[model samples]
Target: MEKKKINVAISGLNNVDSPGPGIPVIRALRESKLYDVTIIGLSYDSYEPGLYMEGMTDITYQIPFPSAGQEALLNRLSYIQQHYPIQVLIPNFDAELFNFIKLADRLKKEMGIHTFLPTVEQFEERHKANLPEWGRKYNIAVPRSQMIHSVYEIANLHHSYTYPLVIKGKYYEAGIAYNHDQAVGHFNKISAKWGLPIIVQEFLKGTEVNVTAIGDGKGNMIGAVPMRKQVITDKGKAWAGITLEDSTLLDFAAHLFKETHWKGPCELEMIRTAEGKLYIIELNPRFPAWVYLAVGAGQNHPEAIVSMALGETVTPFTTYESGKMFIRYSWDLICDLKSFEVISTRGELKL
Candidate 1:
């Protein structure tokens, strides 16, 4: 009997000093024992390395960014479905998840591109600006954060919050501002790119830890892996990390899923202070760049995500080996101009 091959599409392949989850997600899928997989790389930029990586993506297509609106993205995917049917789409960007979540039903019914994503409400509640309230409801501790619409709001922050506060953009960028000037600087810069209501969070001096996990949307946690950043880039992204044996962290992630009934992939950014209190910082709606670490630790989260999207019953993954680690590095892949021109001109490249 011929094994059935499934087509899976993944996005967020911009792997530079700052990485994307697309390439790692594809790698996890290809490692699956349950299915023969054909990887379809969906990228926003032609220069994204995953599109040109030699053997990884069997086919590649450039789609409009979420800023282009759901209609444009749907049109692009609809066109792709005509040529090659896509069974599942695992979006890897937090900025892009809203559009995908909105179109999950349209894609599944009209185009048969099934996606496992959180509901719109679930996505909204997990935003950095809303994290405090969400945590209050879920019984998780979150740093005090206030949404500021103007840069002037930074000057008076000292009255309510102390110095060395954390400045955050709604969609991206987080920095510790030691003074009012730095706070305004981050507010201006991040707001210029991502737009705001900028968020100013109370700084908690703590060890940073993160959990990459997936949920069944019925309060069931399929897979969970906790890791602490051993090395960090200037951007505060993890460059090297190791899995930890932290039952508290695992329980924290499970509580989030149970309270929200979260569906699909997510990353829980946390802070553990001197007193051993864990504070929920940010909830990313999609997989993180370090997601491959979960695969190496024995969870295969991305593969399980695809299986769930296809309506297959996946037992919850209760245990994964500890002491696993990941070190991220960049390499230049040599690619000819022809492949670039093909995707640039036609918006897709097929092998």
Candidate 2:
């Protein structure tokens, strides 16, 4: 009997410089016996994990942007189809998702690749902070916010909200603000740079908890993992994290999925005030930084997503290894470049 081969590919795997949340997604795909994975991305430089993947996967392709163009994307998809014939395509970053949406028709009809993404209107609605209005309709706690289409609009809406506002750009840029002045400053700078509409939000002070999960698009929950962050860096990356099982958060997350009809894996950042009110801050339509911690805990989110995409039954995973601690944004490695004699005799470096 021939072993069944499952071809899986992920986008946005370019080098590690500001590597997106796809790293763990790819790792899960590669490790799982469910599918043989092929990772794809564009990068100017090569690094550790990518280097390792280059040697392991069935295929690795680097297509430089603009130069890669629509033709190049189609060509790569075609070539991969010629060889491995991918069953599902997982887009990891905003740019790739945008491109996939643009070329989704061709990929579907011509190459027969399944791309998982929200509707264009859904993307735009959430992209421009319109989703929060939906959340508000459902009585979900969305911070008091304003949206600006131009720099001139900013002046009209400047004083409407209180201090420490979060100015966000369409789609991907959700970088926050600490004060009204800072919000305006960032709005002006980002507006000048990107020339996109900005959404200004009232900064909420509270404890941050991330709810990461997979949904079946029909208000059915596949798996949900909540994490309480211990240390978050200035760069907005988690450092020293732990997973928590909270039913209240799960209930809230189910409410969100029912409201949005969200499909696939997404991470929502929520804040809890001293009054114990939980407010939805923002949602990333992909995996989170500490997702590997959940993978380590036994959720197997990527595999669950893959199985769902393949029209397989995805059972709920309840027995997650609790009290799992993790450290992100930093790695400590032993220096094997020196001999023990050089270490002991020269400087007496402690282990």
lDDT tens digits by residue: candidate 2, 85-185: 77777776665555666776778778877665665554555554674675666667777776777666655564576555677776544566664456677
* Candidate 1, superposed: residue stretches over 4 Å from native: 1-3
Model 2: lDDT of residue 31: 68
Error of 1 at 96 (Å): 1.4
All predictions: root-mean-square deviation over Cα? 1.3, 7.9
Each model's lDDT? 0.90, 0.66
Best by TM-score: 1
The CA lDDT at 89 in model 2 is: 76
